[model samples]
Target: MTAVSPHKKEPYERMSEPMATLSAFAAMVKKEFIIQLRYPVEFVASFAQIFLIVVVLTLAGLMFAPDGVQSESSSDVTGLVVYGFVLFIYLSDTLWSVGFNVRREQKQGTLEQLYLSPASKFAALASRVALTLLWTGLLSIGAAVLMSSMLGELPFHNGPLALYILLMTLSGTFGTGFAFAALTLRIKEAANTAVNLLQFGFMVFCAPFFPFAALPEPMLWIAKAIPLSYGVDAFRSTLMGYPNGFPELAPIGVELGIVTLFGVAMPLLGFWLYRKAENQARRRGSLSEY
Candidate 1:
């Protein structure tokens, strides 16, 4: 009888599973970049829109203060307006990246393939989130600089502190976006409408463009309920030297704590919800239908 060799898997073969998962995630990020670059006009339009928003806000600011008062409050308001818009842009873009990406995949009939892949669903979602964060973060910085220059005000006081606040703000925003992604998976047909409504709701309730204290009592309660409200307060205080609207708690630290809780809780909740929705879709054999 011929010598029989015992069947054994190679070391590389054993490692192939994890390696493939990483490769898939990396490819997803690269694909996002490529897709954005393929439409050069859209890329340019994004930047143009940022610049136009700054111009309109600047004009309004000038009209409000034609003499350009040099008071501290005036300077703070200018910084608040500029940086607030930057934060809003980042939040909106992140939400779009997560929610719209899922909707697009479903519409193209590719989402089912992703769901069937060996890679974890969260990994795929995170890759898109990372891409959006990088793209929107750069745009936010550029927009902040342009707004500051046009408004004749410098917003960066403590560079390191400002950077920390920015990261915290992004964390909170990403959590919100992650939840929106789950919502998109559940409501693919109305995903765009949901996203638009969310953006508008945030603008009104979070008080990104205005002072939280300026809001009425009922609205103030709504603002307090939203984590982005705390994020905006922290960002404004850190980047613009503005006073914290919620003075009951210790300035930036308390706000950071609140956002940290949100940043941690929301994503976990979103992931759980997403997995359930995905499973339901798979069970119904409707993953490709949406």
Candidate 2:
């Protein structure tokens, strides 16, 4: 028989890196829906629970007002509480949605197998983020509306600017979620404890329920050091019409600069750290271990 010509790679087999990445990402986005369908109850319960907790907290906060719940409410206090609560809702969910989810995969023994597939690890991480953006974004809007009714009509000002800062702040928080996911891979079972500690830190340092001015001078410095603090400051201040005593952490210009940098840089840094951790785990063959 004549020598067989060298087998040529098919066009699909020769897909470029960018196209391969896009295909993997698109598949992973579909995988998000598959996972949600498999655990429909957990998904529904989470959505309900977040809404309830926010309503209760906002209602209870108004109760603490010298005059419990009124037809009309103070715009300043209303904006401070409602806006802060909005950010809190996002951060809390990000912890569970992105960070806790990685630990979940470890416990299910899928984290390792997921990597064995040709799909990009970044696709896996980004898929969870897509879930958070959709899931939490809805919860935030619902909770905010409910809180506005319970707390008071919230001030809406600097609409376009507030939207920008809101997006930037959320972007930075997503980056934080990625970093925490990296932490989960390394710590495995300790993820719960770590999440609790992180939540407490956010509550205390970020002062999401109260204005930065309410925090003591010493405590305020800690908030000042945290970039998310600037995000909170800039977000609420702009939305509240920049009333006196707003943007307590820093000047609006300075805070905006910090939040922009945080939005741009954190995701890049967080993903880099995740890749490092992942490469190490793969090399050590610990990728499958819970």
Candidate 3:
């Protein structure tokens, strides 16, 4: 009998090039943009809701002012206070918007399908966060400016402050969002409740309505420890002409540094937790169960 030839096997595939990775990222980004465009209601609602908040706050501020003075001004305490309020709203809202979107996708079974792709999960998540953050920040700032203009003026001692606030806000908000996204991977049912509670907490502790000094001795330090407070402090200083607020409540540089570290760490941590949750769901065969 003739000897049988050993079966030949195909060579291993080559690693993907840098261009291919960029292409994958671009594709995911496009997909996110398309989804956002299709759901135009969300954008409209976001704009309307922001506008309503601005109007309500403006009226409330006017009502509470000592008289013969506006809630916001180029100089003095009201502008700083209002800036703090606006900053807290912006940061808290950004986190909620991203968290809710993640929860919805998780429930709809799309998140798992996203995991099935060969592209990095972090890249996909980052793209989504980037798009949402960019749009929401713009909307929030525009609303704040328009409202302030109606009531008074924005009180920007320096226009560069806007860029600083934007960077710091993006860093802190996205960092916090990563933590929430990780939590959702494991605790889908309680995600919204958790986010709502956190949002309220930020409003109370980190916003202008309350001063960091007003907290109890123990809690005063705790408030300063939180990232959102640093954000509020930064915006308070820059937008409200309260530059003296810097490096006191919290330094802008330190907050930015901490937030940057969190930005890097939280996403990595989130990705790891997400993978674990995905595997657990898959093993239980409940990937699409929500």
Candidate 4:
């Protein structure tokens, strides 16, 4: 009599690593949408909330405009405010959503089981990014169009370069999201506090609502040091055709270099950090601890 094996490989168990990772990613993305659909009210509320904020901010900018100074009627001002808001929407969503998902998994006690599965951890982290991009893409576009109509025509120049900058900025933030996910694994629920701190911090330091020159000298110095600040500066400046005194942090070339480095390097570093944090959680037997 021949001994028979008891184990049976699942369908995708036979897939190559890349295919398996892709399959897992697609599954998680679908799961995210399904989960999201369970709360239609939240989506409506979110859209309304963002739209209100955009209206308030646009009005406030017009209110603050001095008659002879920084004309609110200037499309330059419109592009500055609206364009920066676009990056703010994305960065806010990326940072908040990614970290929140990780903490949720930890509390649900599935974080450990997820780590044990053969599915790519990177893909799991990326699924959150995919969802954030979709949700924020809608919110940002709505905000932009509404603001453009209120503030005046939007200046869109250097089209290709502006898109490249936008892509790089988004990619860079995705990497930051991964790093935040790593921190969530360690900090657990305290991650929410960190998220608020980061959310407000990005608003102030990244200067998504106004020009960097409007920042106090000390704050401008701080903004200069943050890579995302360069992203905000470069993106809007490029889109506005590098008008007088634009790209406030550095030369366009220098800003481009920094953003490119951030887009390239941060993902590698963030994923590496996430893997380290995850391993520590698993080995310490604290993956399920909240």
Which candidate has the highest lDDT of all? 4
lDDT of 4 by residue, 1-290 (tens): 97766785555448788899999999999988999899999989999999899888777767766752235478898899899999998988898778778888877777878887889988999999998888899888899899988888999999999889898999999999999989998988889899889989999999998898889999988888899999999999999999999988899999999999999998888899999998998889888899
Better of 2 and 3 by TM-score: 2
Over all chains combined, what TM-score does candidate 4 have?
0.94
The residue ranges of model 4 lying beyond 4 angstroms of the native Cα positions read 1-13, 66-72
- Judged by whole-model lDDT over C-alpha atoms, candidate 4 comes out at 0.89
- Candidate 1: worst-modelled 10 consecutive residues by lDDT: 241-250
Q: Over the stretch 6-89, how does candidate 3's per-residue lDDT look in tens digits?
A: 874547654577666676778877887898799899878977887887677667666756663343443434455556656665
The lDDT, on a scale of 0 to 1, for candidate 2 is 0.84
Residue pairs with backbone overlap in model 4: none
- lDDT of residue 57 for candidate 4: 77
Across 1-290, the per-residue lDDT of candidate 2 in tens digits comes to 88766895555655688888888888877887788889989988987897788767777776777877664568887888778878887888787877888888888888878887887777788788887778777888887887777777789999999999988998888889889988888998898899899888989889888877778999988888999999888999999999997788778999999999999998888888888888888898877788
Lowest lDDT block of 10, candidate 4: 63-72
- Give the per-residue Cα lDDT of candidate 3 at 84: 65
- Arranged by TM-score with the best first, the candidates are 4, 2, 1, 3
In model 1, what is the error at residue 65, expressed in angstroms?
2.3
Model 2, 236: alpha-carbon shift in Å?
A: 1.1
TM values, all candidates: 0.87, 0.92, 0.79, 0.94
The segments of candidate 1 whose C-alpha lies over 4 angstroms from its true place after superposition are 1-12, 16-20, 67-73, 242-250
